[model samples]
Target: MMTDQPALPAPPSAEPADRLLADLIALRAAVLAEAGERLARLAPGGDAGAGIHNLANYLALRGHDLRPLQRRLMSRGLSSLGRLESRVLPTLDAVIEAAAALAGAPSPTAAPDPAAFFAGETRLAAEADRLLGEAPGHRRTRIMVTLPSEAAGDPGLVIDLARRGMDVARINCAHDGSIAWRAMAAHVRTASSLTGRRLTVLMDIAGPKIRTEAVATPDKKARIAAGDAIRFVAEGEPRPTADAPFSAVVSLPDLVTRLAVGDRVRYDDGKLEGVVESLAPGEAVVRVRRAKTGGVKLKSEKGLNLPDTALGLSPLTAKDENDLATVIECADMLGYSFVSRPEDLDLLEDALARRGATESRLGLVAKIERPEAVRNLPALIARASGRRPFGVMIARGDLAAEIGFERLAEMQEEILWICEAAGVPAVWATQVLEDLVKDGVPSRGEMTDAAMAARAECVMLNKGPEVGRAIELIDRLLSRMDGHVFKKTPTLRALASW
Candidate 1:
């Protein structure tokens, strides 16, 4: 037993407390100054208004390095500013007031209004309901399934999907004609009525076709391997001789002409990658840099990705303009593919306006799949949401090919945060449960991916034979994950696993 030594003086709190208060005040001022114009431009009396203001505040706040400040705040049992994505200003004000109180100094700010503090979450929920329809009673995340061509002829299939919890039906304009799309839309409507659930039909417009037009191999059976040379030729260019290097024609001739030496090119969803070895008027020779051990087949119609190239091609094509006639009539939402800028949204808006599809009538979803889109996301969100109901789809297939696989995880999280900040619904798309849907066998990785997807407002599954099973499994997964997390916040519901 030791005699009680005089209690050590509490580690001097006054200096650290004062520093925290000052840092917070400075941070608040910086946010307001940087985002003043954007805040002022937001229209009042809507979900978008407060959410956008907070988004602007968050963008500015994240511009500074706050790690040191966070550590100091944590030492004093005050907020570390780590979970302030939705309510940026309110969190700062609360932390500042607490710091002042702890230091026995005059409170620099008054208490935050409770309503203002929670408005971001409320608005985000409202926006999700408006754009994606209300989530099911059991879960907050909605499920969107791409309709296969067979869906046009099978009413039972669509109805079963609805019964299994398909909240939204996606019709890809890249595949079928208007008649088939109308049939698919009609099936969705029938399914909705039969299942007694409100379902949304989203028609995705095919932006630009950057695909392989043809493939010419010496043996016709040899696959592309690492160190192999392949020439990318333009349409109408003469095919290389059998003895010449293996060659493939690109659908976009102009794009091929613009490729410079050393530019990276990915094929078939990045299964194979190469670098430009040389460039000519109508073709570029690429040396394969990475592939499977043996080799991989290069097929016509597979997608081609140029991550290092600046492709200024418009998202709209002649085919898309024609497809809009069906989209404007049948779709509850329009998916704008490859939308990389504010102007891309404007072009689509104008087109919709010409067709008498007002903002209230159709929801617009910007499919972000390019680096430029990631860079310009804030402007794109502001432009779209300021006009009408809006959402963002993380088109991961092309995005991973563009921004590298290593950055995909980080970028998707950032995207989710920004979308949450603006009260915009994000649809987690591409390869959600590919193995299970296509082969009736789920992988451990895909199962984990599906669980992680619950953080998004919606999860999109591509068409496959066993998609109904995929839908049911993801529905259960999302429901389970719902009690554990929301956006980046971890909910501490009592755990049963202990």
Candidate 2:
């Protein structure tokens, strides 16, 4: 059993490092105490409020970094830091006392009341809304739609989306050039003006995307079935055809060399699955495990997911740096992708500072797609929250692939809970009502998925021919579900009479 006693007090030390440590501890205590006072209003005995306070303190005592602790409390409970201090302040005091003794200073008592930390909860929420250009009295969640490439030059289409309920317009930086991005922003501005509604433009930085580069196939598509063997070769290597068909090359050659035998590989958004059967210096042989009757076609530029291997690559690529400049110039918000560590957020902040951008004013939506990002989410959001108007995007497609399909639902819920703990909004992204947007007909399953997405602070629709109708339908469903469910909170708003 763990003992309740504190470690024996350290011998008095006059060293400079000891003094610095004491100062840091004092500063941290002050911050915590201030937070405690602010959260005191939440009523420490209240069921929900007390749980948040306890978790907050629990994380603080463990000396976990600010972000990870915040995220843990968030994923595990509710309320932001201010409300979290009620339970954490006592442990915080004990920690401070121990540090003070170690530094040879008089042992300090409990922290001052938490009043200094009492910034209202609405303060941060309002800042997020402002960054996203959300108007007063609008719905709690916003609707964002990825702009079709053609929409850059079509002001009418942009305007139509705004009229139908597009609160934020997303421009994927990976696909188009600066000219196209500028045009899309201009069209969105025009539409906002014509419709007398403001729309925020969000540009996504495509970070180190690994994809199938090309395949040695005459028909430009390679079909594979369960039990088929395929060779993954590095570019310029001797392309060896399998007994069933041809080999495929991946965009990132290094990943090919790194694949280990038995590692699971998924293609085309997890539609095709393969196991690495053998490995070579610049190639791997894979045995297909999942495929349709028509067989899965391996196409150029489709995403490749290696769930079991550590991908050795920088999170930020040269392409991302070039895109950041344009995003800063033309977008209200920037979507950060492939982030795996707190240092990655630090890199982004450094870049923003170097570019003369107002870091705090620009909305930075962190895309949670990788396992590392999820594990480090609390710290990620903590770092992000310190630097800018922050939110999260549950980038479900790659996320589902990264963590495995079986755990996608649980992962999404944990992400949502963590975001709520941080008190920041989240955007439910990828393939929401995909059929409805692409084919102008909603599938029964997708319709249910859309309703589920209403729980998030925002729902994103990928650009498609029928996105306008998709937005209309989404708006109607969201309106119906508004008072019924919100982030696990049941609303008792009166139902409409038939």
Candidate 1 wrongly placed segments (more than 4 Å): 1-15, 37-48, 241-244
Over 90-152, each residue of candidate 1 has an lDDT whose tens digit, in order, gives: 888888888889777987777678888777888888888888888899999999999999889
**TM-score per candidate, chains pooled:** 0.93, 0.76
Which residue pairs in model 2 clash with each other? Answer: 37-114, 57-88, 67-378, 67-379, 68-379
Give the distance in Å from residue 431's predicted Cα in candidate 2 to where it truly belongs: 0.8
Q: The CA-based lDDT of model 2 is what?
A: 0.74
**Candidate 2 residue runs with Cα over 4 Å from true position:** 1-124, 135-138, 217-222, 242-244, 496-498
The whole-model lDDT of each prediction reads 0.87, 0.74
